[model samples]
Target: MIIVNSVEEFGQRYHSAKRWRRCMEAIANLHRLNPGVCHSIGDSLVYRLVDGAAPAAECFTGNRRYVEIHYYLSGSETVAYAPKPGLQRLAPYSDETDRETFSGAVAGRHAASPGQLLIFDNDYAYQLLGSDHLRKMVLMVTIEGATFHNK
Candidate 1:
């Protein structure tokens, strides 16, 4: 499922954990750093900031073992997503990368802007499209069973 919410709302939902709180704190300070930088806040929790020209076309990717939380920091973009079954595999999911590339028609598109957070689970394939200068922070968290574990 795809969830579009404010970053504050996402923090409220996952704030109980110390690691999540740390991740939230790091997100708040991401603006101070330059673009094209990636850092690991904790085990299974990665923080990535992208600021540059958007992709030329939609390249859908999905993960089976991780949940992705994308927060737009500046500019704007459209996120196109489709269910896994509707996509044709371009690359198989890898345990090291935790991502599988796919190509297909998107089910829908969401206009994303600053302060907006888009959450995607393992069942959906998503692609970011259409932006001249998009600045966003993505937090990829590994999930095990029903528990949300960072390490």
Candidate 2:
């Protein structure tokens, strides 16, 4: 997991990621945006805009084929993070949605404000617990390179 505090930092680290570069370009083009699918970079990448209250811990979500970047455009939010080792699954994994919700004791909660990004890898489960209102963009990229297990 990585917490990026600014675009400069995110660029410095993940600029080589083509999908992430494309997503940033699309975000720059949006002057007037709504709450929905903003852009699809390709089959391996997707960018979405979510404006709503974050769900509960029972609704914790994890992905197997993708790593996610949650960029808080405005407002602030917290997310619960835990590894898959002992976390109890709430439902079966959905290939179509690429999400598997689980419930268990979390390692800790993380908070991000505007201009901050939460980067989650494929092996860990992270839940975005929201506030009354939050505006954030999520970039989901297909899994690639070294995983946590290998390191």
Top candidate (lDDT): 1
Off by over 4 Å in 2: 55-57, 145-151
Instruction: Name the top TM-score candidate.
Output: 2
Cα-lDDT of candidate 2: 0.78
* C-alpha lDDT score of every prediction, in listed order: 0.79, 0.78
TM-scores of the candidates in the order shown? 0.84, 0.85
What are the per-model numbers of colliding residue pairs? 0, 1
Q: What value does the lDDT take at residue 109 in candidate 2?
A: 87
Q: Point out the worst 10-residue segment of candidate 2 by lDDT.
A: 142-151
lDDT of 1 by residue, 91-147 (tens): 867877788999998899999888888888888988877789888888887665534
Alpha-carbon runs more than 4 Å astray in model 1: 145-151
